[model samples]
Target: MTLLAAVAVGLAVAFVSLGAYVTVRQQMYRNLDDSLKDRAVQAANNGVLTNYYNLQRISSDALGLSDIRVGVYLDSGQKVNAKLSPLPPMNATELAVARGTAPDGYSIETVGTPNSPHFRVVAVPARFCPREDDQACDDGETLQAALVVAQSLKPIDRTLHNLGIVLWAIGLLGVIGAALAGNAIAQSGLRPLARLTAAAESIARTEDLRPIPVTGSDEITRLAVAFNAMLAALARSQDRQRRLVGDAGHELRTPLTSIRTNLDLLAQADKRGGLRAEDRQQLLDDVRAQMDELTTLIGDLTELARDTPQVRDAELIELSNVVEDALLKVRRRASGVEWDVQLSPFPVWGDERLLGRAVTNLLDNAAKYSVPDDTAGHRTDGEPLGRVTVRLLDGVLTVTDSGPGIAEADLPHVFERFYRSSEARSRPGSGLGLAIVKHAAEQHGGMIYARNAPNAGAQFTLWLPHAATQSR
Candidate 1:
């Protein structure tokens, strides 16, 4: 495409330049012919033709003309006049002009001894000359004599040849310049498309939806904008799919584990001959707890799968109050563990149920990881007691726990579906808690991060954009 465009532009310029050159050359030739014709007319008007009888007497003394030849022919086709040089035969065109039937223009033809190039000018008399002297001549009256002036055209032809060469040279130079300019323009115009192609290929190979930079307001820039938008949309869709998979696994793990545990207990009871009432009661309680966990996990997963538009359309509420309520619920579940709660006014825009679920997950994570059997400021093994801290401030919710900190290797994977720390494998909680919190944070135009605190525990922070009413 670029090469074709360059060639097209170059040819157009060359054609225009050639046309102008031809026009100028034609005009110059016409002007030269007109000037020569006018000079001939003036010579004829000055009675130079009438003096042809005395041409030998004054031939060397004639001014302006280096050489002149004159011929006077009678209407009867007899030569009536002569000059120093012998006359050449009248060609067909010159004869027609002398007879007053040719158009008014000069004619070039070879004549005379050497047969060199020559120009001829013919003039007709107004009436018969001296056949009868004193009568008024009509417009169509045949002339008795016609004057013919001839000049050598060798010099003018030589000049025109040189001018033609010069004009051709200029035209050639113009064509060369046009080709160079066309090439430069083609390169400049196509560079953006080349970059766009490269960016598209890179995205296709890597599936990385990075934006391509646009540098102009041309059509190519608009194409780049559309390409980047498509990439962004693809990235968002892929992210949503990943979130869905993680949510599904996280939501199913707890129920599956509960069902497996209950089945194992039933198998052991069967191996004992007969099941006791107490054993039956304990099994029933376990089954109920597992069922409840399954129901809660399913509910959380369904909430996560719901589109954010529906959630965002819900009423706004104080995020701090939601955190406080979740902490109270967690305290009831972990009555033996010490609690450190800090609450401040922080509003958010989202469904209160979704927000509350997010807060519940964070609090639940902290409570689950808190020291299990600590009493009187120490564990049964004499280890220091651990505390769960829930903080809400500046539209940020954080939960920290003083227990065995998450391993460095596991910190990054904590929010992944079905991913639990090594110490958490034997714990009685599903791994979906933090994952749910992460999704909830994102749905609210926020993000969540988990890391080991500088002290001796793990910290989870959820940062959300402040609600519109809480802008101040």
Candidate 2:
């Protein structure tokens, strides 16, 4: 903006100076031409063309001009008086004017020797007839002659040179003033941007995402408002990240501690020349269980921490098949739990493996919370619950268990990473299973929610848009 303003100012100054210079120069030349015309008129009225001696006597005194010359020419293109030649010889144009053929009456021409100064000249046709009371004569060929007048142009040139110097000085000053004004305007206009930059830099240095103050109704103000909104979002994301890291550390400690304890116990047993085979086998089983729990926790953390799950390869998947696959995998691990599954055509667009994992998580969660039923297939005072109902209709899949339902107070946070209610604290989990399920659902343009069943335990419902209608 500053540079553009400077160029505009310079152009304006140039145009104005050019116009003024032209007007002043033209007026000066007009005045000089008028003076030369007046002198030529006077010399013609004095009958300088009728007598050769009268033309020779014409000098600076005849007209109030310092550098002037006068001459007379006949129609035959012959000078009337050679002694009156203070200027250059008449050229073809002057000869034509004398013979009444050229159009120009006044001209600027170089006179005297080639090294001499230039002059302004004029030619007026006249009659050389004898002077009479009435100074009128017929336009006869023999009576035609041209009265020539010349004046030096040095004064006019000097005046115009001085004017040019003054104009250039004024133009230079105008450009300087415009540049200064443009700089001031640009600085004031960019002050808000400078403040915004400083605020961004401060955020970078301090790792703080506090919003900057915004004021005004311009584009810059809108940018500031958007920047503040971004900062607020970043602050929320950072808080979630910090909480996730803290919870992950806390969850890892339990299994890691148990593994270390089991290893230490085995080391002591080895030092005592080995234990009984059954005792050693039990210790090995406990160690293996702890290691498996650690592995599961780490894998859950990895799934929960994935930021760009949708970047994985996507395909049109039969969600019913995914659920059945999950049920088959869980059936191998669940010895006595009964799975009542009713699958139908449920197609969706997503990463098929991730969707399968989500379905598997839901089944595993249901199985983890239930106990195997007794021989009568009924719950006793000491027996835990066992039964799962998996159903799919249209694009919605629901998994329900006969175990205890989630507490109402913990329902809202069920899908939050590393969140577990007090009732679930004793369960062996890293609290990331439901979070991963929620992320997978959202990444596939779907949603998952949990609610207490009408008569029994909790039901988890996942709704995915159908592949035919899902947006890319």
Candidate 3:
């Protein structure tokens, strides 16, 4: 930034210096040319070269001509004055003036090389008068000679040189000042950026997720706002991790205690000269069930602990097939409840495994809650007379159970991690099933909703977006 500022300033300064120098030089040359023209008229009228023989003895001051070198060129382009100091060179313009071809004409040019003092030479038609009473000297019809007046340009050159030096110094100083100003702006105007960087580094070292203070509205402030959002997301993730750990520990403790107690009982039986086969078999069955429960709980915890969902392996799949597959899986475990299934072809783009898992959890949850319908009188066979209806149409999946609906107060938190209703406390569950289902639905850009049915049951509806065939 500083370099760019300096370069911009330097270019401006250079342009301004060039324009001013050109204007001043041109104006000075005009003034000099005017003065030289007046001097040329005087030299022509005075017939200065008639005294060329005594020019060495005559001072230019006596003729009121100061610092002027005078030369005379005849009509044949021959110089008559040989005693003039630094006689100006005669070019075509001087010859044209003396030959009467350009009676009122004048021309100007610079004479001499760079190593020597240059002369600003002007050639005008001279009214040559060799004597004060000569008829030809005052005659207007004749061209006798060209009065070529020369003046040294050393002073102008010196002034321009000094001006150039002054402009150079100014440009250099302007560039330096621009660089310093740019640096100062970086220090003060960009102070917020520096503060943000320092805060990020400090957060990295200390592991603190505190938000930075936001002030004013600017691009940097907008960046700070976004950074604060990122920090907030990170903090939420950390909190979720903490809650998951605590909930998982609490849930795992129950199964672990039961397994430990069973093992202790079996050991006591063995130390007492072995237990009966029936007791030993029952103990082994209880231990195996506890281990399975532990495995299931751990798997649920792992599923819920995922930080981000990626659909790189997603496929366009029919939602009906996934529902049918889930229904089959839950049929054996929930055989007591009647399933009323109605499905249709519903194409959706999503991770098949995740979608499949979510569908299964929804079915399992419905079948688990569909208990015996005592309101209609219990069956003599002890099988639940309640029904779990699963219907799919378009991109929506609806599962409703005709057992006990969720309470009005517990409806909102049904899908929260480790959240269980009063009636669900005694049930065999890890309380993470619904949470996993909701997470999958949301990750796939779908949504899930739960509500009480009109009669007496809970209804869960899952909606997914249509498939994007272009992605294929």
Best-fitting candidate, scored by TM-score: 3
- Minimum summed lDDT over a 10-residue window in model 3 is located at 129-138
lDDT (10s digit) by residue, model 1, range 15-101: 766686677657755665565456556654555443433433445226454454555554456554343544534555555555666
Off by over 4 Å in 3: 1-8, 26-85, 92-112, 120-133, 137-151, 189-198, 212-228, 270-283, 309-320, 340-349, 373-384, 469-472
lDDT of 3 at 377: 28
- Give the clashing residue pairs of candidate 3, or none: none
Instruction: Assess every candidate by TM-score.
Output: 0.47, 0.62, 0.76
Q: Against the hidden true structure, what lDDT does model 2 obtain?
A: 0.78
Q: Give one digit per residue, the lDDT tens place, for model 3 in 1-472.
A: 7888888999999999999999999999999999888877766666554333334445566766557676777786667553535566777778887876765587788887878778898888765544434333346543477878788899999999999999999999999999999888778878999999999999999999999999999999999999999999999999999999999999999999999999999999899998899999999999998999899889889988985754566778888998988889888777677888899998887788888888988888887788643333234477666789988988889999986899999999999999999888877788988998899888778889999989889999999888863243
Estimate candidate 3's alpha-carbon lDDT, on a 0 to 1 scale: 0.82
Clashes of 1: 0
CA RMSD (A), model 2: 6.9
- What's the TM for model 3? 0.76
Q: List the residue pairs that clash in candidate 2.
A: 88-112
Instruction: Assess each prediction's global lDDT (C-alpha) against the native.
Output: 0.67, 0.78, 0.82
